[model samples]
Target: NDYGKLGRAGEAIAHSLVSSSAAGRVAYVEPFAPAPGEAQLGARNDRGLLVFSGCGTPPTGQHEVARGVVQVAELNNPVLLNFGVSEVNWWLHYEFAPVCSRTVLVAYDKLAEWDMMAPRKPVLEQVRAQLLASSDTVVGLSEGSIDDVPDASYVGHGVDRHWHDPAIDSLPEPADLAAIPRPRAVYVGALSMRFDVEAVRDLADSGLDVVLVGMAPHPALVELAERHPRIHLIGERPPEQAAAYLLHSDVGIVPHTDEPFTYSMEPHKAYNYAAAGLPTVTLNTAHAPALGPFLNATRDRKEFVDGVRTALAGGRLSPDQVAQARSLSWNRVAEAILRAA
Candidate 1:
């Protein structure tokens, strides 16, 4: 499936990289049913690279066809096989190995802890090792994530500066957000298991207008929002619209649960909030320290509550903090990756 709006950080990164860079082209291959009349082997685009879809679902067939497509594409143009997932697709990787010019593995999360359904842990470990061994360069989302990989580079996620700039004060506030009371704490991103619903509940229970701008309601989160009148699930908005909410809101929050997955993740929202010049508060995690003074990293519930209150009281980020955030733009990230490639 195409990477739609409002999910998958890796997909967002890929889109940003492709759109911004002058790289020849990007041939995206996905494991889903192809559209009617779509070429099974290869296709080309006048604007940029062609996308070959429908590589067949697992436990069936079509692996050979996908391999052939990749081999043909590589021979004609430089091929960069970038793997964003932790688990290695053995068949696909092995097929592309001979033709790929450079292999890049992006470590966005902990593989073992992420896939709880998998019965065997050792298999994942072996896959990770094999993937890393075959990769020419390892790019980690956070510093802690790259420690195990040999010759890894730490490239944190970046925000789109043009869309998310703090200087865009002329933009009108989102209509739903305008109705909400001031001293607002806005949380943008997926409301998943990692989200600290209880903490958000606490903020709502404290009479603060807690606005959630994301995809949908996590069942548990839905329950909390239903219970509290102050908790506003504004639903998903476009990136530009979301930036407006952040800029106009009192404070931005990163209310994620304390878990292993969060430890290795450098939440892209953190940078987004910072770039918008919004006072940010987050539950303490491995990547929190690197965020510097721009973010308020709270240890527990009490601290989180207090941090929100502190942010609501009208704290501002230092000039250096703003500069630091602006420096981590998607354009710079794409440039660095292209240079390395």
Candidate 2:
């Protein structure tokens, strides 16, 4: 299947990297099956890269994906095999080793250091060691250290700046957004354990209409929405549609619970909010200082409520602030990777 059909961080990177690649310079291979009938292999030119898709359903194992990747890799004779961490599924990427002249790993997050991910650390550590031995370079998010590998590069996650902009103000408002009373305070990422439910409730109690634009599988959050008329759980949206929600909203927020894992993140949502010209207010964290001046880091629930009011008053980001965010585009990130390779 094509990455474009999905809506996740990995899909975002795949789109950016492929869009940045020169015509016919990159190829993507994945394990996929359109039906239950037979093991099928097919290739097509998508965007700029040749995509080899469809292996089989209930995929037998990693070897099946590896075999297809090897065939495509040999044909393309790629200079670098760029690997992004996808948790346990990374084992599949490991199988495609030695296919390219060099290997590079994009450390999307520091799962090994996260307490919740402790159970998988042993296997991840083993993979880390193997990756270190084989990788020519390791690029990681700036919020966390990448000392596991020598001389690893630390950089922030990138956004497709054009996709989120003040110009979206001229576009039609999203149907679901029309009835949500403003001044709207929006949060546009996962509603996971890291999310601060208390903080959101405080904002709603303070009279700000709170909008959450991601999956709300967590039962607590669902109940909170049921109790708070001001709080709206609008469900998950694709990149483009999600950006519109940010652009139309009064302010963007990251109400993450004060935790080590929360401190370890440099959220792509903040970057997206900045690109959309919203004043982003986030819960204070260790990485807050490094996130630049455009983001307002509030220390407590009271501060968070105040931060939203302050953001609503100040309005969207200034021209210079927008430019700063725009400069950090995925095109530049892809260029850096290509140059490093």
Q: lDDT (CA) for every model shown?
A: 0.69, 0.69
Clash count in backbone of candidate 2: 0
Provide TM-scores for the models.
0.83, 0.82
Off by over 4 Å in 2: 5-10, 19-24, 31-45, 53-67, 70-76, 85-93, 145-150, 161-169, 284-291
Candidate 1 least-lDDT 10 residues: 54-63
**Model 1 alpha-carbon drift over 4 Å, by segment:** 7-9, 12-22, 33-49, 55-79, 88-91, 115-120, 161-168, 288-290, 314-324
Across residues 1-341, which tens digit of lDDT does each residue of candidate 1 receive?
44444445544555555576366455665544535553344354423445555534333254465456656455454545555544435545665556667667667665655536357567776777787787777777676666676688777667664544545657888888899998788888778667888888888878899999997678988888888899989888877778889878878898878766566666678888887777788885565444676788776877898888988776656567667776776666666566555
On residues 1-341, what C-alpha lDDT tens digit does candidate 2 reach at each position? 44665444444455566766451355666645457677777777765556777745535445655566557645465544444444433554555554555667766555565668788878766766666566777776544536455577765666654554656556677999989998898888778668888989988998889999887547889999998999999998877778778878889898887765556556667877887778888885444333486688777889988988988888888877777777776666666666665
Clashing pairs in 2: none
Candidate 2, residue 217: the lDDT equals 43
